[model samples]
Target: MTSPEVDFTRRNPTARPLTDKERDALDEFVDSIHYSSRYNDDHYEYRHVQLPKQMLKKIPKEYFEPSRGTLKLLWEEEWRGLGITQSLGWEHYEVHEPEPHILLFKRPMNYQPPAQH
Candidate 1:
């Protein structure tokens, strides 16, 4: 939630798949909600089908949309990607993108650092 990332620890692989526990977390966000879960041999991803009031709520008080890109910025700072060297590839990050709304939680699992900055 903090990072917008689906944490990809080995046991969970595609990172933390939403379980009953995560679903429970969404209660705070749910006025109504729906989703679809998908999986490959290795990873899993669940797309948000519907957003209830709780999830639509603003950061502190009222209801609004959740900006995943904004969340990802906070998350990268928290994760310290800023401290890592920048590469043309996945090992480095944009730190911030031109479109904050577009960059969600994405950790390139197959990232290979490019030769130049």
Candidate 2:
């Protein structure tokens, strides 16, 4: 809820168009590293993917029945099927869509390059 980026204020400055180089770089960057584990190698990348229906059916009964917040979290897990443990394991979840399901989980943070020397 409190991201520093939220503090930026362009207010009403004139909208200058993007530069050609910036535009090209932006295009290339966008085209490069992308979404979809199906497209890229799962090597070390950890993703939040939706678990397949077959796999999801095996979730614990308690997990299968989630509360509002927990259901939302389960929805994400089911949607993303989150990749975990170096592609070895995945967190299971369930969503009680009729009502709101609430659950708490500690997810791995997105990857960050190591600091340069």
Among the numbered candidates, top TM-score falls to 2
Query: What's the residue-level lDDT of 37 in candidate 1?
Result: 41
Candidate 2 segments exceeding 4 Å error: 1-47, 68-83, 86-117
Reference-based TM-score, model 2: 0.24
Q: Give the distance in Å from residue 44's predicted Cα in candidate 2 to where it truly belongs.
A: 17
> Which 10 consecutive residues of model 1 have the lowest summed lDDT?
56-65
What is candidate 1's lDDT per residue for 4-112, written digit by digit as tens?
3333221111222234553455445443333334222232222223333334223221111144323222232222221212223221122223433222223343445
Scored against the true structure, residue 15 in model 1 reaches a CA lDDT of: 22
The per-prediction CA RMSD against the true structure, in angstroms, equals 14.3, 20.5
What is candidate 1's local distance difference test score?
Answer: 0.29
